[model samples]
Target: MNTHPLRWDALVFGVLFALVLVGWALLTYDLASVDGLAVAGLVTLIVAGLAGIALTLRRTS
Candidate 1:
């Protein structure tokens, strides 16, 4: 039988994604405006994407 090695990148990505969701929820609840939600969601997604990209680059390098 063959098995694959454990990966930390997947774990990190999941954690970061979850954090983005939590942050967006909190921001939506606190701000309660379409504009606010849009801004918050955009920022949260950008930060998460950057983290994921950095992790991928690190692994490749």
Candidate 2:
């Protein structure tokens, strides 16, 4: 059985994943450029995105 808190956590994780994906895709698609602070932002997004996913999946296991 899952609680509301867990469900919310999962949702947040999903959103973060999507955000990171979009950021990367934007760079790849040439729709945006990531330089300087933008580079840092992407790195943060990638790490945070992976961590969020790991936490969400861990909760399921």
Candidate 3:
């Protein structure tokens, strides 16, 4: 039997994944006119998006 505490539920992960997908879409289509700060934000978003994906995969496996 497994015994552990549940922190975030599936809905949370699902939302994170969905939001990251949206960020990726925005980065892809709107990167031409972004400033330096916007570039940094996009990079951070990419890293965070990867983290979200990895966490979701880890939770599943």
**Which one wins on TM-score?**
1
What lDDT tens digits, residue by residue, belong to model 3 across residues 1-61?
9997866677667866776676677668874444744676688779878998999999999
**Global lDDT of each candidate:** 0.78, 0.79, 0.72
Identify the candidate with maximal lDDT. Answer: 2
Q: Global CA lDDT of candidate 1, please? A: 0.78
Question: How well does candidate 1 match the true structure in TM-score terms?
Answer: 0.51
Candidate 2 per-residue lDDT over residues 1-52, each given as its tens digit: 8765458778877987887798788888888877743876778879978997
Q: Estimate each model's TM-score.
A: 0.51, 0.47, 0.44
Question: Candidate 3, 58: how far from true, in Å?
Answer: 0.5
Off by over 4 Å in 3: 1-34
lDDT of 1 by residue, 12-52 (tens): 78877886677677766784565766786799779978997
Which sections of candidate 1 miss by over 4 Å?
1-31
Instruction: Identify the superior model by lDDT, candidate 1 or candidate 2.
Output: 2
> Hey, what RMSD does candidate 1 come out at?
5.2
Residue 29 of model 3, lDDT score: 88
Which candidate would rank higher by TM-score, 1 or 3?
1
